[model samples]
Structures are given as C-alpha cells and as structure tokens.
Target: MARTVRDANPDSRTARARLEPRGKPYFRNLEPGLHLGYRKAAKGAGKWVARHCTGEQAYEVETLATADDFSDPDGLAILSFRQAQERARERMVQRAHAAAGKTSPLTVRDALETYLDFLDANRKSGLDARHRAGAFIYPPLGEIEKLTTAKLDKWLTGLAKAPPRIRSKAGAEQRYRVIADDHELFRQQ
Candidate 1:
C-alpha cells in the first residue's frame, strides 16, 4: 500500500496550538491554485476550509468541517486533519465538475438514463442497477445540469439516517411504512 506524507504544521494539533487566532486561515497549497485551510477561532476549535483560484485575482472559498482538536473525528461535521484535506480535494473536484456542467446541455436524469443504457448492453446486472437507480437516484434528481455537493450530501445522509421500513400484509396487498419516520411521506426522496 502507498503511504501518504503528512503536512508538518496543520496536520498536528500541537503545531496548530502554536499559531495565533485570526480571520484569515493558515493555508497549505495542495497544487498551483488549490489550497486547504485551517481557520482557528478564539473560543473553540478551528474549521477546515478550501480555496480554489478561479481567475487571475478571483477565488472561491468554502468551509468543509470542524477540526478534530477538542473532540473525536466524526468524518462528517467533525473531521481529522487528513480527512479535512481529503474533503478539500473532493470539494475542489466537485467544483470543477459543476463548472464543466455549465457548458453541457445534458441533465442528470439524461446522464443516468444513458449510463443505464450502456450498462444494459455491457453488463448482466443492468436490470438491478436500473431498478435501484430508479427507486433511489432518479426521483429527486430532476432536469438540473449539476447537483451541488450539499444537496448530494443531504440526500445520502437522509437515506442513511432514515428509519427501517415496516412491511405489513393487508388483505392481498403488501405495504411498506416507516413507523413515526418523517421519510415515510417522501419515500421517493
């Protein structure tokens, strides 16, 4: 397995404590224009952020998650140093995809269908994939060019956190229900 080299300062909590709190984040350049940032506050643990240079002087910035300095990492809202860096890179890639989507006229639904067609021709599990995608991915995703990371995250989190469905046989028909779960009403989501 390949091992990743850790950064010196931001990768360590002890090293971070030596730095002062400020509005601007301490940045480590991942590439020519992409940077991962740690923004420390005076009262609590810092947040992980990412910066992407768009043009000559323009840049895009986004806060990723809370640093796992005072608490254990959760891999979601709270992130370890390495996790933060990985999330930063993922966000940058998503941004690039969104930018590319601006010129493409295809919607997400169209892409999914096209992929399904390809899978059906090339793979044996295409029917299963089509059913699963239709049940899960195809509904909420509409005629949009690109889905934001936040939307995708929320949709996946909702699926993970949703309560188990309760199935009951009534007369000759079988029905699935979520007991006291808010997602019961929006099962297609």
Candidate 2:
C-alpha cells in the first residue's frame, strides 16, 4: 500500500513538504525571499527559512523566527549573518577614522582668532611696545595653539620682506626695530 501524508493540522489548508538534507518541511504558502532548510536534531522539528538579498556578494540571513531553534542548519546560517554584520560595522568605523585624518591640522579661522587673543592679552599686560607691534604684524608669533613653529616663522619672514605702511619717521623706525627684535628673539629660541 502507498503511504499518504495528510496535513498535520486539518483545520489549516496549508500544505507542507519535507525539505531534503534534513527532513523539515515548508508550507506551500511560504512567503517570498524564504529559503527553506531542515534541522538535524528532531524528526518533528520545524523548518528553517532565511531571507535573501541581491548584490555583488550574496549571503543568506536566517529569519528572526528561527533564532530560538538552534538546530545545526539554522545555527550555521545565523552565524554567517552575524559575521557579515560585524564586518560591515568595522568597515564603517575605519572609513570614519580615515576621513578625520585627512582634514587640516589647524583651520585658518581658528588660527586668526587665537592670534588676535594673544595680541589683546599682551597689550593688557604692559609688555614692551616694540614686542606688541611685532606680535601684531606677525600674529602667529605669539602663543597661538595648533599653529606650528615652522608655519609662524614662514609668516614672519614674509612680513619682513614686505613693504611697511607709511607713517611718521619715528613710527617707521619703531616698526623696523620691532621686526628686527622679533627676528633676533626667534633665532635665539
């Protein structure tokens, strides 16, 4: 006599077939994107189904429904999904770090603000007038964070060679002296 398999639940119209490799069966009305597989442990254990995505790389991700059923096939699929997710997360973090590394060390706007603040602080302290003027012309010579010493020296060199603004003879002499004094101080340090 031939064996006939009837529906497990007579009240339900769904027809299930046992998937091979493991005998778990899937319902005939299974939703799209579902890949049915079987569990290894129990004969009556439910089917394992995973969702599929299309891209340059294809991988199976077991549906959340199968998480509680830790049979061999489901376990493998879940592990693969977790590994993919972790790799993607790591790549994103690395990309963020690389992007940050490419930005300039000191922004011009920030450097300008720091230089102005240095001038104001020195003026209030009754520092030498020549030093104050030199600090004004070479804004970066004073204490300005993030501007490297080499960059400040370059700015000062440009100022020394550039023509001075015409003013009273005494004022011009004072400006030249300030520049000369600053040059000496920078060399000594």
Candidate 3:
C-alpha cells in the first residue's frame, strides 16, 4: 500500500480545537490555493469548510460532514490522525471542481429561475404572480452581464408595452395583475 502524508483528522478534538479563532485554522498544505478549515456552526457540531483560491478570489465551501458524526459516543476519536487525514484529503479533491470557480458566468434567465424557485419555496401563493412580474425582462435585453441603468430603462419600456402572456379565464376567473414595473420603483432604489 502507498503511504500518504496526513493533515489533522476531522474526527479528532485536537484537530477541531486547532480550527478555533485562537488556534491556526488551516493545516497541512494539500496543495497551493486549496486548504481545509474547521467551521464550527452551532457549538461542537460544525463541519469542515474548504477554502479554495480561484479567479483572483478565495471561496469557502462546506464539506457538509460533521466532525461529531465520526466521533465515538464519549467524544473520543473514531480514527487515528493518519486515517482521518486520508479521508479529509479524499473529500477535498472531490469538492474542488464544484467549488473552484468564484466568478462563474451567470445570465438573466438564471437569476429569474433562481428567484422563481425561491418564491415557490417561500411564498407558495405568490410564485405565479412573481413569474408574471418578471416576464418583462425578456426580448431585446433578454440577457446581459449584470444589469446597468441603461438596460433597466429598456426593461421598463418593454414592460409597459409587452402584451400579456395569458388573457384567458379559468374556473376561478383569472384577473389582470398589475406588475410593479412603475418608474418610481427605480427612483426610490
């Protein structure tokens, strides 16, 4: 078997202590721009947060596995420093690709979709209304690299003139909703 260099074990209390504010949060350099962080969220149940440098910025991502989960009932370590170190190394590599890009490309449609999902989850009854309110940002200025004042003006014009997507009446009698696209919305912001 191939021997490996080990970082602090995730299951060790000593390792967890080292991640606190007083102690050094980062340990053994698995590679440049990539390292482990002991993230304590609530009391002794926090997980590891991996900090990776990418696109001229550092991004911290949670590994989602708690140190307490691996420890024995009495809080004694379940694995040796060497064994836990090996496991942490493996997990770090697996998470690199997903968390590497801090400045990834994002479009207008993506933002709208995310917002729609949020509305559906948080404000269940308002999801449809929210979708209608946002449908105006399509057409000539459908997508852009972040919104500028000029793009927003164009969006306002489009909203006022764009025909409604749905005008049919259903069992409940669909009524027209006034999308909050008034110019005052911009002036106040």
CA-lDDT, candidates in order: 0.82, 0.42, 0.55
Best by lDDT: 1
Over the stretch 5-57, how does candidate 2's per-residue lDDT look in tens digits? 85332111121123233444332222243333323334443433333433455
Sort by TM-score, best first: what order?
A: 1, 3, 2
Report, for all candidates in order, the number of backbone clashes: 0, 0, 0
Tens digits of per-residue lDDT for model 1 on 1-189?
A: 999986538888888887789999998998877898999899799999999999887988899999987999999999998999889887777777788664446788878887889999999988998877866687777566778998899889987876654554544443445454367657755
Highest-TM-score candidate: 1
TM-score of each: 0.50, 0.20, 0.33
lDDT score of residue 81 within candidate 2: 31
Judged by lDDT against the true structure, how good is candidate 1?
0.82
lDDT comparison, 2 vs 3, better candidate: 3
Model 3: per-residue lDDT, tens digit, 73-186? 331333343444555566566655346542445667666666777878888756675546444454455477587889888778866776455565455544554546678974
Candidate 2 residue spans exceeding 4 A from truth: 1-108, 112-146, 168-189
Which is better, 2 or 3, measured by TM-score? 3
Between prediction 1 and prediction 3, the one with superior lDDT is 1
Q: Supply the TM-score for candidate 2.
A: 0.20
121 in model 1: Cα distance from truth in Å? 28
